[model samples]
Structure formats: structure tokens, C-alpha cells
Target chain A: MEKRFLAIGWVLSVLLLMGSLSGCGNIEPWVKPYERDRLADPIMALDGDPVSTSYLQHVYEAREGARGGEGAAGGGCGCN
Target chain B: MAAKARPVAAAAATSGRGLTMMLRYGLGLLALLMAFSTARASVLPEDRADVLYHLYTGGGVDIDGPSILVRKQVGKSVSVVGNYYVDMVSSASIDVITTASPYTEERTQWSLGMDYLRGNTTLRVGYTSSEESDYDADTYNFSVSQDMFGGLTTLTLSYALGDDLVRKADDPTFQRDLDKQNYGIGLTQILTKNLIATLNFETGTDEGYLNNPYRSVRYFNPSDTSGRGYSFEGELYPNTRTSNAVGVRARYFLPYRAAIEGEYRFFTDTWDIDSHTASITYIHPWRDYTFTGKFRYHDQTGAHFYSDLFPSAQATNFRGRDKELSELTSYTFRLKASYAFLNESQSWGFLKKGSVTASVDWLFVDYHEFSDLTANALIGEEPLYSLDAAVFQLFFSFWY
Candidate 1:
């Protein structure tokens, strides 16, 4: 199981690294120095800002050992 | 004396020049440190605000209730958050004593959080208090994070302290005083623009009374002549436990406005129990709305010496109890989906630039037992597989 997890991690890391590097290739093309205050838009801060409705729903569920935020906080209940 | 005076005169001249240079260098170093500290706290834009509220309702093997949270950024570097939650649950768990009452517990929780960002670092502090019918608790948490490797990597360290006071009706003298502490360190690396990976490790420790005063193990008389029929008063006191967990999660962007994330966690505790959790999620984005779906699986082994019954005439100094705490195991499966709506421009009279989200979750759990003590012990009448729960939640957030 450990080996399997490792293999999966390695593959995902490589894939993501490649994607991020390649994505930088287009930075100049779509680069709008300013785009209507992305922070004002919820989608841009989807990962960090916890004040969103979905974030709360997921946090509560994850703390309860239930499914939550896009597969985040997947773990056992310490109290259980 | 003349030669010495000549060298001293020359040295004095050099000393004057060197003193100024050293003074300037010192001032520059001080300025850099100040800049570094400030850099940790990045300023938030003045025109942005966010608020959110959530409500949850559900029942099954697990019960869900309602919760609310609201946050606002009032300054360039400061945001305040408040949260409250209430839950009423009836749990028929597959724990050590399969036969205990379906715990109908009531819980209330409240918390406040503050965050400051400057330069390339963020600092956060929060305090939380909770009451669950017979139990009361208070917790404090602080964390600091710094962006590394030019924003590709982030490192964070967090610490938390908790105090619990549990009052039980069974033992008038029973005061379950507990102290819990946790320390976590994590790193998040943006491997690629579309892929983010994070690794985190946490250590938690609990000290003081760790047993349930109302729960007891019933000992049965063995057929042998060894007077084993008498039940023993079992109680545990002042037990300390520590737990450590490591987890890794990654996000992979897919084609056509979609992304997939996968996560794995491994956990173990001083009670000799080990567990693992795995989960996957997929996100789909549309013009003004977004949807997400996720599935999770978790498995755990029970602690050592956990049982529902024991031999009454054991030769050792045994707590002749029907329930042994360390011998039960369980597994759970959960599925959830959520949808969110983003506001493009000001909607309400005030700045209403927030998002609304709603989600549903389902969970199933199965319990297991270890020994005959557990087999014969009166457990919950419900089948092990009868535990299931469905949760629904709606949340709305806006900023000024």
C-alpha cells in the first residue's frame, strides 16, 4: 500500500510539474495585467479564501469525518 | 612616543570613517528585517469584503444540525471571522461495547479568527469554545505561513491548545479534566500552474481522564469453580495518548474546464490503532457557476484491550468490566457534491460580491468486535451495517 501510494504521488507530481511549467508558456498571451479585481470574484480565490459557502460546507463535513471540499480533509474521526 | 602618536593619529582617522560605514550598514540591516516582517503581511484590497453563512440538517447513523460563519476584512492586513454550530446526533457505533445506548448528544460550538498578511507571509490566530450537553471545551490556535521559492512553495506551522471539562451524572466525584495540544507543519508546492501538491504532518497529545464514567464492562461468571460470576467496577483514570498523522494531496487539472484531486492520509496513535483514508474529487466549471463531486473511504483498527466483556476471575489486576475500550474497529464511506454561484457585480444595495453554495453528503459506517466478551455483551440492537446518514447544507456569503 505504501508503494502504491508513492507511485501515485510520483506520477501526479510529474504531471502537475509539467503542466505548471507549460502553462507558464502562455503567461504572456492571456496576461491581462488587471482583470476586474479577481479577488472580488470568488472563483479566483477558490483555494485560499475560506469565507465561501462551499468552503464552510466542506470544512464542517470533513471535521465530522464525512465527505467535504473537493476531497480535502479526508481522514478518520479522532473521537471515534 | 612620537612614533606611537603618529600611528594613533592615523588609526583615529580610519576609525572615524569606519564608524560611519558600520553605522550605515547597521541601519540597512535593520531596515531589511523590518521589510521582511512586513512582507509577511500582505495587504488586502480596500474595496473587497466577504461574508458567509451555512445551515446543515440530517440524520442516520450520524446526525447533522446547523452551523453559521461570517467574516469581513476591515483593513488592508486584518480580517475577522466568527463561527457558530449546533448538532444533535444519535449514534449507534461499532465501538468497544456494541450494546450501549444510541448516544443522543447535543453540541454547540463558537469560534473567532483573525488573519494578517504582509509581504510574503501570513499569520493567523483563532479561539474556539464548545459545549456538548455534559462536556465543555475551549481551544486556541495560531499559525504562520511564508511563501518560498518565489510563490511555488509555501511552508506553514500551526499550534493549538485545548481544554475539556466533562461532567457525568454517574460519578458524582467524576471530573473529566483533559488537556489537548497539537502541532502541525506543512508544505504546499505549486508543481505546475494546474497542479498543486501539499504534504502535512500533525502531532496531537491528550492528557488526563480518558474514560467514560457511564460506560462499563460487564464480567460474566465462568463455568469453573473460580468465583468468576461477580462483576467488577472498572474505571480508567489519567491516561495520556499521542497521535501522529501524515497526509499528501494533489490536484490535477483536466481538459475542458475540469480538474481532479486525490488525497491520502496515514494515521497512528499510542493506543496501537492505525488507519488510512483515501479520497478523490472532480470539479467542473461553467460560465458563472461551479460544481464539485467527491468520494472518500476510510478504515481503522481498534485499540488494544478493547472489549465489551472480560473474565471475572482473572489472576491479574484486571478491571473486571464488560467493555474493553481498545478492541473495536470500523470503516466509513462518504460521498458529497456541492454547487456554487458567483456574483459578477454589485447585487444588493451594499457591496454584495459574495458566493452562495449548497451541498449534500451521504455516509455509511460498519462496526466490528474482537472477543467473546464483545460477542455476548449486550450491544446496540441495530445491525452493524444499519448506520447511514444524509446531510444537507446551504451557505451564502457576501462582502462589502
Candidate 2:
């Protein structure tokens, strides 16, 4: 099982690297300033509410065996 | 001839005065343009603050708390943030009631952070500290993000280190220490004008005294003249553990100004535990209100050392009876709504850009291979355990 996990990790790493390299050229569309209203909306933010996200993150960390990869790690508890 | 010369002189004087007036008007226009440019250049992002109240109840536990966060931009390229969070927890779970009386405890956590941006790169550093009746922890974190492809893609790298001190509230001499570290990398890309995707990988390590000192393991007894029974002993665990997780998330905007989001995560650990999580969310916007619905599913396999009951003769060096280490599956459903009461660029009194949000979540968990120890002790037969929980949150945010 450990070996299989390692293999999957390697594959994912390679795929990410390849994708990044292949898109080296400027393939992205030009976004005009006036067309950025949607992007600037609060809903487009990765985390719209910082305090709520922090509380939820702490709850999940205390309940589950898995953690991290979502965002910055802060705060600790003695839930167990 | 004299009269003609006088008329020519007057005409020359009139032309000269008109030229002077034009120069004065040009200078005045230039000054106004300079002032407008300066005002535009000096305008910085607004400072924001948030207050949230959270309540949780279920599974013989109740938690309620409030948190506050504030962020301020120091200049065009620097920002600072601070937060304070508190949790008041009361538990009467099976394990707690079986071993000891029900108890209530409080935990407080505070954090401060700074961010710096230059060109297409951003740097962040943060510190956190938390305190409880029997535990204290401190953590430090740093991260860097760089934008590529003219802001179409962003790459991030982050690291965190934590030191924790654990002690028994009743025993002053009992003390233990733990260390934890995590390393992570992430990539976010805009696939199309209406689609965005993100991928993240994280690896973490924990060392020194990873088990809860208060928890105990149960072992079946065979030699007793009395009926078959179980004995409780202090639990033991490995000293070090390493874990890894990979996650992928994507969002697509609909033609009607709505959005759909999906996420999946895979996790593995050195303790031979594996887990998977999948979730979906839909967000809809009205005139001044936005509503969201989300659902999540999670499943996990038991750790190698975890067991409901162990035979005395078959006991190993490491024993674990913690329910979190047991095979389990869970589901979560959530609904949220937010209203932008004040979204105009102009400020009202001392506040600007305000929103109020409220959300509710329901969670259900089922343990597959683990049984209720309390029930087993009473009836001599174990029954499967399940839990139902609910969470509520209300948030208010405003910018200045």
C-alpha cells in the first residue's frame, strides 16, 4: 500500500510539471479591466469568510485523522 | 495717422491679454489633473473586520463560541491581520461518562499574521498560540505565492511547525511534549473564463507522545472465576507518525450568474490508515442575496493498531481504542445565505461594504468496525455506534 501511494504521488507530480511546462507560452485570454467585475466579486474569493473557515477547520482537525492542504494551519485544541 | 496708430496699439494690447488668460486656464487644468492622479494612486484597499458566532451540538457534546478577526492594509504592498477565537465545550460522551464524570472546558486561540506583495509574488508569515485547561500549543507558519501567465495561474508553497505541551489537570507532575510539521504545495489555474481549478499536496509529521494519556484500551480476561469480562489499561501508541494528502477542487460559473463547485481529497498515513473525501456545492445569487448548498461524504479505514477489544494473550506493544482510528463513514449537509446590506463604494458614517451571513450544517457518522464500549460493558455484547451532530454560524463583516 505504501508503494502504491508513492507511485501515485510521483504520477501526480509528473503530470503537474508537464502541464506547467507545456503552457509556458501566453495561451491565456486577455481580460479587459471593465470585464473583471465578476472576478472582483466577493464570491470569487477562495475564502469569503476567514473566521468561519477557521472554526470549521479546527472542528474537522479534531474529529478526523487527516488534516492539512486546504489552507494556513493555526490554532490547537484538546478535543480528545 | 495718429488715430490709426492708437487703434493698432489697443488691438495689440487686447491680443496680449487674451494670451495671458489662456495660459492661466491651462495651468489651472494641469493642477486639477495632477490632483486627480494623486488621489487615484493613493487609494488603498479597505480595512475589514469580522465577528462570527458558532454553535455545535450532538453526540453528547455541546460547543459554543465566538470569534473576531481584523485586517488592515498598511500600504499598497503590505497588510496585517489578527484573530481571537474561543470555544466552550461540554462533553458527556460514552468514554467520558464511563471513565469519569461529565466535564466542561474552554479553549482560546489567538493568531497574528502579515502579508507582503511585490509585483506578482506574495509572502506571508503567521504565529498562533492556544491555551486550554490541560494543553498549550504554539505554531509558526510561512508561505509564498507567485502568479504566472499574467495572473491566470498561481503557485503556492507553505510550511508550518508546531510545539505542544500536554499535561493532566489532576496530576501536576505528569507532562508530555509533541512536535508537528507540515509542508505543502498548491497550484491554481483558470481553465476558462468561467472555470477555475486548484490542486494541493501536503505532507506532515508528528513525533513524541502522540497518544492521549487519559484514554485506555480494553482487554478481554479469560482466567477469571467470574463470567468473561474486560479490563481497562492505559493506551500506548507509536512515537512517530507521517501522513500525506492530495486534494483537487474546481468551480464552474453558470450562465445565470450561479456557480457549482466540487472537491475530492485522498489521504494516507504511516499508521496504515487511508481515507477519501468528496464534496459538492452550489451557489445562487439574487438581487442582494446569495444562497449556497453543500454536501460532503467521507470514508476511512481503520488503523493497524486499532481494535474494539484485544485478548490479553494477543496484546501488542502498541494498543489503540480511539474511535477516530476506527473504520468510519460520515455525511455532511450545509445551507448558507448572505445579504449584502451595504455594498456601495461610498461609506456610511464610519463603515462600508457590509454583509451578514448565516449557515447551518448537519453531520451524521457511522462507525463500521467499532462498537460502543459502554454498551459492551453493560450487556456483554457490543453494538455499533453512530452519532448525529449539527453546527450553526452567524457572521457579520464590514470594511472601513
Candidate 3:
């Protein structure tokens, strides 16, 4: 099981590296920056309320056996 | 039956003086790490403040607290945030009532963080500390994020270190040390104008004094007759543990300005515990009110050393009866509402927007292996234990 998890981690790393390398090329973004109004909508925020989200995640961690990988952005991130 | 089998048994001498304290804050360390996963674009954080009240009641346990958070930008390149959180717990749950007496405990935690933005890159550093009567923890973290593909994708890398001091309430001289480390990576991709997705992976490790000081394992003793048929011995656990989790989430905008989000996570640890969790949420906004609903499910396999009842005294090299380590399935249903009391058209001085949000989550869990000792049934015929809990949260947020 440890080997399997390690292999999976490696695969994810490779995917990230490959995706990042693709950004090195002269490829054009499929979604133009100006067309991101919908994505920028407050309702569409993946981690909108950092305070509330992290608090609730804290509650779950107290009771559940599982932890982490919740994908909360941050209490403070350089995002305006 | 398990509790009636043995009333007071202590193996605390194995490790030292037997001192017992609740571990309500032991898990807060993980929250600190998850709070700053740090996946943001090449923009500065918005200035905001939040005041929140939370309550959780279920299975004869009551937890209530208040949380305050504030964030502000300094100049054009730096942003700072701080959070103060508390948890007041009164527990008479099945474990307490069955093994020992009821107790009340309080935990307080505080965190400080800073973010710096430079061109298309962002850097963050943070520190968090939590304290209780029997436990104290301090953590330091750092993260970096970059925007690529013309702002279509954001990737973040983070690491954190936690230092913990564990002590026993009854034994003033009893103290132990625990160290933890966490590593994480996250990616956010804008798939389309109306769709966005994120993937996150985290790995963590812990060493030294991993088990609960007060919690005990049940072992059958035919020679004893007391409150229960068994005896309680201090739980023994492996000193080191490693865990990994991967989660994926996607959000899509509806045709009519509504939104739907789905998420899934898989977790595994060296203790042989594996879990799968999933959730789906829908948000609908009508004028000043936004209504949201969600459903979440989680299922997990038991740890290798956990058992509801051991056959005899000192039956296993390591023993534990912590319900959280048992095979179980849980479900949660959430209802939330947020009111935009002040929007662009209605701003108040320095505030850009303000909202009040309230939410309640109903949780249910079924333990596949753990039994309801209060049932007083025969040993093997004991019925499975179940739990129902209600979690409530109310908060006000303002962005300036």
C-alpha cells in the first residue's frame, strides 16, 4: 500500500511538472482573461469564505478520522 | 457490557504516571495546516473581517465557541491576517459515561499570517498556536504560488512544522513531546468561462506520544465485578504515523446565475485507516439572499490496532478503542443562507460589501464495529453504536 501511494504521488508530481512545462511554450490560453467575469463572480469562488470554511473544516477534523486535502485557499492569500 | 466488565484499570505505569485529559485541540493542529494551503492567483488578498459563533451538539457532547478573524493590506505588495478561535467543550458522551466521569474543557488557538505578491508570484508565511490545560502546540508554515498559462492556472507548494507538548492533568510531572510535519501541493485551473477546478494533495507525519492520555482499551476480566464486566487499560499506540490525502473539486456556474460545486477526497494512513469522502453543494442567489444546500458522505476502514473489546488482559501488543478509529460511515446535510446586507449600491464608509451568513449541518454516523456499551447486552451480541449531531454556525463578514 505504501508503494502504491508513493507511485500515485509520483504520477501527480509528473502531471504537475508536465502541466507547468506546457506553460513554457507559446500556447495561447483557451479562456481569455477578459472572459473570466463569470469565474470571478463571488458565487463562483472555490474557497470564498476562508474564515468560515476553515472553521467548519476544523469541526470535521475533530470528529472524523480523516484529515487534510480539503482545498481551502487560506485565511490570507495574495488574491484580490 | 464492556464497561460493566472492568471499572478502573491503569497501565499508565508502562509509560509513566497515568494522567488523563481530553484531546479536543489535538486535531486543531491539522486545521492550521489546511487553512493556509495557499492556492491563490497573482493578486493580493482583499481586506476583510469576520466574527463567527459556532455550536455543535450530539452524542451527549456540546461544543460552542466564538471565532474572530481580521485581514488588512499593507501598502501594495503585502497583506496580513490574524485569527482567534476558541472551543468550549462539555462532554458526557458514550465513552466518558462508560469509562469514566464527565468533564468540561476549553481550548484556545490563535494564528498570524502574511502574504506578499510580486508580479505573477505570491509568497506566504504563517504561525499558529493552540493551548489547553493538558496540551499545547505551535506551528510554522511557508508557501509559494505562481500563476501560469496567462492566469488560467495557479499552482501552490507549502510546508509546515508543528511542535507539541503533551502533559497529564493528574500527573504534573508527566510530560511528552510530539513533532509533526506536513507537505502540500495544490492546483487551480480555469477550464472555461463558467467552470473552474482544483486539485490538492497533502502528506503528513507524526512522531511520539500519539495516543490519548485518558482513553483506555477494554479487556475482559471474569474475576472482576463492578460498573462493567471488563477493565480499562491505558491505550497503547504506535509512536509514529504517516498519512496522505488527495482531493479534487470543481465548480460550475448555472445558466441562470446559480452555482454548483462537487468535491471528493481519498485518505490513507500508516495505521491502516483508509477513508473516502465526497460532497456536493448548490448555491442559489435571489436578490439580496443567497440560499445554499449540501450533502456530504464519508466512509472509512478501521485501524489495525483498534478493537472494541480485547479478549484478555494485555491481549495485544497495541490496543485502542477510540471510536474515531473504528470502521464507520457518516453522512451530513447542510443548509446555509447568506444575506448581502450591503452591496455596491449600499456601501457603509470604508466597507466595500458586507454579508451575514448562517448555516446548520446535520450529521449522522453508524459504527460498524464499536458497540453501545450502555445497552448492557451480552458480550458478542452488543448492538452497534450510532450518533446524531447538529452543527450550527453564524457569522458576519465585511470586505473593505
Q: Against the hidden reference, what TM-scores do the models get? A: 0.67, 0.82, 0.87
Indicate the worst ten consecutive residues by lDDT in candidate 1 chain A. A71-80
Distance (Å) between predicted and true CA of B172, model 3?
0.7
lDDT of 3 at B108: 86
What TM-score does the first chain of candidate 3 have? Answer: 0.61
Best by TM-score: 3
Model 1 TM-score on chain A: 0.30
| Per-candidate clash tally | 31, 0, 12
lDDT of residue B364 for candidate 1? 51
Q: How big is the RMSD of model 1?
A: 17.0
Better of 2 and 3 by lDDT: 3
Q: For candidate 1, give the lDDT of residue B377.
A: 32
Q: What is the model-wide C-alpha lDDT for candidate 1?
A: 0.49
- Deviating ranges (above 4 Å) for candidate 1: A1-80, B1-62, B90-105, B170-172, B222-238, B313-342, B370-386
- lDDT by residue (tens digit), candidate 3, B1-400: 1111100000011111111100112122222322322333467877999999999999988888999999999998999999998888888889888888878888888989999987666789998888888888888888776676567767677777788777877789989987777767777888888888888877777778877787888888766677466887888989987788899998999999999999999999988999999999999989999999999999999999999989998898888898889999999999999999998787899898999999999999999989998899976688999999999999999999
Misplaced by over 4 Å in model 3 are A1-25, A73-80, B1-41
lDDT of each: 0.49, 0.69, 0.77
